[model samples]
Target: MAWLDKLKALFNFELNAPLINITKNSGNSNLGKEYVNSGEKIDILFDNLSKEKQEKLKLILKEKVEEGSKLLEEKSFGLLRELINFQRTKGEDKKVLDFFQNLIPKEDFEALESSLYLRRRFQEKRDVSKLKEDIRTRFGDRGKNISNLCTAGYFENFLMPLFNSSKEGFDNIYNVVVSRSPMAIFVHSAMGEDQITRDIKTGLEVSKKYGIKFLHIHGIGDQNIRTIKRCIYENKELFNYYDKEIFENNGIIIVELIL
Candidate 1:
């Protein structure tokens, strides 16, 4: 026990480092492996660490469990299972979960659900003409093209909240409105003038109504652009006034577009 205490003290300094790699035969390697492999069921591993390290690691693990519990409450058990499976397959490491969970917040998960629903609506809505007619009647044709409208699964999930309110269902309205625009007609390269022009046009419309502008800083593929153009051409009424030249000057480079 005295030797174990001495060993713990010797490696105690590594606890706070950004990363600590332990080999199988390193002083505390066996203990580390034991804790990780024990189904997170063993409490003895905590006894080997210094008080400070124990407290820090405990807080981290507790946070992970709490996050898992929250996911379970939301009925996102698949995600919870994925997390556990990842731990089981990769060898249980509290640090990995700690880092990953920190990257994703609860709001992000909820937004993902909203985006999914919006995308599904886009696919299911059959009467393109009626949808465009309805929108033009409400918002007026600010050069929007209906056919080119498509919902961005991930991007919309993240940026929707910044410009719209949840209570008013602004995100849903915005998604519907944007999908029908000519700018939605192409996947503009973030740096390409074509994409920038579309984004600027959309931003202007959004700003005029909501007093907020959404800058599309990312670039997309030519294939996607072609697809959007095809969608727009099919629904001319939705894109009658879309401007093409304005975005060329303002489009950001592709590298700069990632969040």
Candidate 2:
């Protein structure tokens, strides 16, 4: 009971996990903090749970989220098709087609337009077939990943600091996405059952209470990872990053928690 109370306190009595510094940063930092909370790991950022068990909150199944995503894509394409048709009927004015440029890539918009014009089902592949077919390491160009989700909410909160910038010190990343929308990280890749809290306050409470700066991480595959290697090349301070393995490689599930 005492340990549980301590855990509760570390979890911030009652609330979803806050960014808790490294939890958002996502690396061995949370692992140490989780252990310091000696604590635990679950999901961070996207799904903040664990604190819910006290009064309780049920996590939505990743499958359900996937199903919903599929449905949305379907509906979105259907509407897109009708609008594309409307644009064709209008001829010289391509307002509908022009509008989509803001939402999707030029190639995707062209493909969708072609599919609509041909009265064919536009194939949508979420796996990012274009980026790389079997990349052992993933980047957040599209699909769900922490590297991309780090762009959410307050941009400066984690991004600027991670990039080693207050007023664009390391890179003018702010300008990179000035007009771009934030990428989405799906639920399937978010949390695992064995992990503890992804709640923000809980992670901060653990580190704040325990006081940790230097973090630890396991599993290294490259002599220099693409992201890190780039930083090293420029001799810039490395930006903190997080990853969790959803699968070992056999299945579609593969997300690696860096810590």
Candidate 3:
């Protein structure tokens, strides 16, 4: 208890913090195994530090926070690329292309327009009509199938609102908050695997222990949306993250998208 109290002080955590339980029940147990520790290791490490070391660590953390703020300001064009590519494969209607163009940086939007002109010029020499149609068919079928399951809508309705809203709005929105949705797209080398796993596990455990549900979405594979929907509708409890009441009563679903 004293160690935990020291932990609360060291990490600036509130007293009586809820414990989160993360169980690996998906084919992606590797994803689930990532979330077993809840920063107890950090607490232990901090506990072993001398008073001088603790103060030094605090200064380091403060510095990192300032650095992270700067990094967040760097303009991210990844989403723009994804949207534009999706539109291209799906056969862009002029209205949709215009909408997406409006969302990108002016330079990027211009580049896309130039690329389209080049594509049209090359179209005369190559018989890519079939190839283009194939791409549209494959992606369109996949998109429509996933959309039917309403997993995107589920996240948008239940999970996204939490992130999109202020802290106070999140707290006030639900009487019994069920789960959290974490997209593990950071499996890339940019961030450490261990760190991402630990963060996910800790977040899920804490949320669940406090009666908030945590749902993890693996952002790597072809999302089997229909299967996930069946599992939810049938009350199958296929994964370790399952909360029966939440799935049964509210038609709550979880699906991962490439984007």
Candidate 4:
């Protein structure tokens, strides 16, 4: 019983996982920190459960959390839609839209706007056929993916960092992939599930072996832009195109802690 109690402490059942750290510069960092934290808390809860309850809890926890996450995603998407609509209605000064659009290329901006508007109309009018036709006309085969992006909370926390990063003059990022899902390694490690943790550990190793910076925005939190700024400050080499190099070289020089 003493050994078992000690083992339970390892699970950190009392701990609450960290939330997405939004700041003045980096807005949301949509890293799905909530989702990751939910998983971690469940892991801790699982440790305290009776074996019989643990099995049922797994299914129940996953289901309830997923349902809640779906609703949150919907709400976030609705907020995003409203913001976009407001931007569109504003006459000449599209400063809000311009601020967001500056983070990505013009083509992506156009595609994103078209996709959001089409999906909104479909949701409001409940016309699947019209949506499909618009999809085919505008997006062709990529329509489904586009629709998915529109519905999902893609912009909520993910795109916020770009504003600060761009302002810092580190704007030449070749490609940016914002994962709304947290790394499994982080979840498993938090849960104290050592057996399966090795699998994710290997995956993390693989990413690192390839020198993949794999920017972990959740873990980095509000420090992300500042971290880059510091990297540029400390090393003159990264000053030219730090953002692009950060992505290109897996951020070996700039973001060791985040990776």
Clashing residue pairs found in predicted model 3: 20-205, 20-206, 21-205, 35-201, 178-213, 179-213, 180-213, 180-214, 180-215
Give lDDT tens digits, candidate 2, residues 1-259. 3433443454454434431121334354554343223233233332333455323222222333444532234346555756666565845224434544454455434443443333221123233322222121332232222222321222234333544434443233332232221121122222332221222223333333323222211111232132223332343222124333333222222122333
lDDT of 1 at 252: 21
lDDT of 3 by residue, 1-259 (tens): 3444444555464544244222223233334222233443221244445577567655655564555522122123333444466456645434423643544345434433433433443334544344334333544433222222122333235534564555564554222232222332122223344444464565556555544444443222223333344344453334334432222223223333211
| lDDT: worst 10-residue window of model 2 | 212-221
Candidate 4 Cα misplacement greater than 4 A, ranges: 1-96, 122-125, 128-133, 136-146, 165-259
lDDT, candidates in the order shown: 0.38, 0.32, 0.38, 0.40
Greater lDDT among 1 and 2 belongs to 1
Error of 1 at 77 (Å): 29
Best by TM-score: 4
lDDT at 127, model 1: 32
lDDT of 3: 0.38
CA lDDT, candidate 4, residue 164: 59
The estimated TM-scores of all candidates read: 0.23, 0.18, 0.22, 0.28
lDDT comparing candidate 1 with the true structure: 0.38
Please provide, for model 1 over 1-259, each residue's C-alpha lDDT reduced to its tens digit, 9 standing for 90 to 100.
Answer: 3433343454443233322222233235645432332332222344555678656665554564555523132224443554465446543223323322333344433333323333344555533344444444544433222222224322333234433345355543444444443223234323344544455456556544653323232233454444444544554553454322223222221211101
Task: Order the candidates by TM-score, highest first.
Answer: 4, 1, 3, 2
- Clashing residue pairs, candidate 4? 28-157, 29-157, 30-157, 30-158, 213-250
- Residue 100 in model 1: lDDT: 28
Candidate 2 positional error at 135, Å:
15
